[model samples]
Target: MDTASSSSNSTMAEFDYLFKLLLIGDSGVGKSTLLLSFTSNTFEDLSPTIGLDYEKNCWGVVSDIIFLFLYHEAGQERFRTLTSSYYRGAQGIIMVYDVTRRETFTNLSDIWAKEIDLYSTNQDCIKMLVGNKVDKESERVVSKKEGIDFAREYGCLYLECSAKTRVNVEQCFEELVLKILDTPSLLAEGSAGVKKNIFKEIPPQSDASTSGCCSW
Candidate 1:
């Protein structure tokens, strides 16, 4: 994986495809932390995202693809009106829940999933159920089986991740992007150019080692 510090026209030209992916769930499920971990490979206690926050990531495995990630504030009713617009043009959605919180898990199906179905323009949008904060295993109320069951019932992929520990953080996005790449309809909508000044450039590095449970 690679990251950019500048979204120059030359930098944007390197991408072969572009995709819009969203991170959503009840607030405090670590949506912002998960994104921070994935993009910068670091974690910190972040204040809740106001309105919406997004980051542009240029990733490559087989080919270069630029991802526009929209992080939504899901727990606040005040943000409801903005959600319809947020769901537009999304090719992938990461529905997140904190494993220690039961309500967050339940709301994935009861609330967030319904909104996605109602507002998403792409009927075939790939969704992933991510149980975040798996490092708090002792406090976890939502078991792995339950997450799998929900994913199966919801017709989406599932995984448990800890942003603080960096467990499966990279895998989460990689799998989502791979699925989008595999889908013919999504591939047909790929764009090569992105608006300038959206991302920063970082020198490429070898894959970072991920170890331990909660320690960063």
Candidate 2:
């Protein structure tokens, strides 16, 4: 809920906890847009690329610093080899899907989770199922109840967000961070991997007016 210090600006921060999180899903889903939305709080018509995009953000108080290294991987098949490498030592993996694309939603367990299990150092990595571009309610092929049900069955946190509208973007990250903060076992489990955690519950936030861009 407080102003966050971006990775671009926090080169000298004295961080206590460092976590690596990956944004992964189908190629056309808004992983990069979500990253930009969180870090810069703006949206752009970002062209798809094959390389990994990194952003850092610092949260919590000065004494209990939490630094997150966010990696937005290109979802194209050509980048699969490269993106999988980024999964090493990841503490959190956000499996994103386009709400308007039924195929993308269906691929959550079949494609992304399987790939994550293959490369992720921590098998019990914090997982979140994010349905992006909920702003396109008219064209949405995936329903909120369906997303929640799938996430529940998959044992992952679930959220629907709109990166373009900046709705739930902050909450998405905050919820993941809170989950990490609360689970000590997960933090200690990172073992030589590029991840860690803290013990703090994510406080609930009041739902306010807010409003991702995705299509089938």
Q: Please name the candidate that would achieve the greatest lDDT relative to the true structure.
A: 1
Candidate 1 lDDT, 1-216, residue by residue in tens:
544333333444565777778888888999888988887799999976666666546665554545454444546676445676677777899999999999999888889989988899998899999999999999999999999999999889888999999999989988888898899888777665433232221112211122211111
* Alpha-carbon local distance difference test for all models: 0.75, 0.73
Across 14-124, the per-residue lDDT of candidate 2 in tens digits comes to 455677788889887898789889877899867774656666666664346566677766678775556445777677989999999999988887888788767877766
Show the lowest summed lDDT stretch of 10 residues, model 2.
207-216
Candidate 1 minimal-lDDT segment of 10 residues = 207-216
Backbone clashes, candidate 2: 7
lDDT of 1: 0.75
Q: Candidate 1 regions off by >4 Å?
A: 1-11, 193-216
CA shift of 35, model 1, Å: 0.3
The TM-score between candidate 2 and the true structure equals 0.81
